[model samples]
Target: MIMDLSKQVKIALDYIQSIDVSDIDDTSEAGRIFYEKFIPMAGEEETIYKIENLEVPSFEQTINIRIYRPSNEKELPVVIYFHGGWFNAGGLESHDRPLRKLANLSGAIIISVDYRLAPEYPFPTGLNDCYNALEWIILHAKMLGIDLKRLAIAGDSAGAALATVITRRAIQNNLNKILCQLLVYPVTDASLKTPSWQEFKDGPVLNYEGAVQAWNLYLPNIKEIENPDASPLYSDELSDMPSTLMIIAEYDPLRDEAILYAEKLQKSGVAVKQLLYKGMVHGFFQMGGIIDDGNRAIEETAQFLIQNFNK
Candidate 1:
């Protein structure tokens, strides 16, 4: 272990060691299942009043979305959530508990977006699904009883990358309603050459080689690696972007990039708050089943949105 991980994470890693999915390609069926095993814990389901699945139309295909409403209050603020899976794995089900807890804690309706994965759908497809889903939500806000004027975008890891891209796209469209972001240990850069990436080269959870593989699977065109839409860290216009709450894990391979992005956001005069979890590794934010910090990340991150949304 590169860092002193939490006891909970230590035990969780021990269980991970017992699994045979390590050698499997992450985009493979068994590999995706391996990612989910880390966070086997469920949330306080009673806290959420409703969980419904719906679909959104995009140019390429129809994407699924799971809505989590803690209450039936009229015109509630909402958080559009994208699940983390390196743009290959992860889905609405894997991230359900964290979204539910955030919805309950923030008193905001949380919508989990089921954007398409990579190695099949690839770049722009998933991004398009997420961006179009946001547009759909904005257009149908009244019917859904959500306050379109108060909206936030959130995601972890690869999904977080999509969330940032979506927010940037929303800004370009002059959509000021999308005003806040909750990025949990996001993949801000596609270069995958940050110092932390090298530091955690062996990974307690995510490693540099694994990240490279994910990027390879995601971006079909190598020339687009530095494109702003493909990698938000390369985007020059950050001044008018949404106020952000960046969640970071100290031992994560992507740690330095998150910090760099936070610095960029601050330098651009955007409102930014960073919540760093010491003694933690990558993907810990959604591991509530094994570690208390997973839920703590949700609880702590909820207030940022609540305050931003004025809920």
Candidate 2:
């Protein structure tokens, strides 16, 4: 049984529920407008030593990537990040404040990808965009002054699924630059059949229907859920994957899937670290303003990434 939510988390969920969106379909034009305008509660912005935005051409369109360098040191370890919004809503701005904190705390260069959203761009499109962007960054690591030897990948929710998929793909192609991966409340299995899925169907933040809807919009073909390409949980090979830090929330619908994935990684000889925030909900890693654990998650993430870089 899940424990009671922390005072801060309860307050945050109450505030979110108070918002009026009775008529706005979250996937419609009005919904996108609302999400674009809804600046997630952000912490004070920190100025990293260097930050720049670049565009990489993808098969679908140009991918926009924001680069954050926390120091002037040459050949710094780097981590590529993908933001989570259930495969549709989040982008650079929605995640800027936390990324800055992550970069500053970690003292490593960060590259955050802005992949295409779904219901329009759909499955392989977003996945391909993320992969192509990483491929381009790897190709230009020297020019970007990054240490390819210490490269890592990180993401949350849908983004985490992408991160692991790419990590596996890299292993398959023998492109072994990714040394570690950090996943925060990752949504790994699309089957939505976990005990947590049944438990948190009416999520404090992420509900079951919304999750299933997002998957449907992102993946039109229902049968694709089994395609390991769509759900990393079904991937046959977890061996040779990078060291992993999986941050899970006890009250989250994705909890069981993430735990199962972490177990799979551990069984396959990959070093896996798991953190279960007792009272937290999905997407709390980016909610620093609302919960202290959010900032703590970033600090822990930085520590893990630094550990991998130092190794």
Top candidate, metric TM-score: 2
* Top candidate by lDDT: 2
- Report the C-alpha lDDT of model 2 over 200-311, residue by residue, as the tens digit: 8988788889888888888899889898978999987998888999999988999999999999999999999999988888878877887899889999999998888887
Cα lDDT tens digits, model 1, 1-311, are 43677788897778777777756664467767876765565434445899889988888568898989888899998899989988988898788777778888998899998888888888988999998899899888888889888889999998888999899888888865676999999898999879998888988788778878888888978998998888889999888887899999998888999999999999999989999998887877767777888878888888788788774
| Residue pairs in collision within model 1 | 41-289
- The C-alpha lDDT values of all candidates are 0.85, 0.86
Q: Any runs in candidate 1 off by more than 4 Å, and if so which?
A: 22-27, 42-47
* Model 2 segments more than 4 A misplaced: 1-3, 21-26, 30-40
Candidate 2 RMSD to the correct structure: 1.7
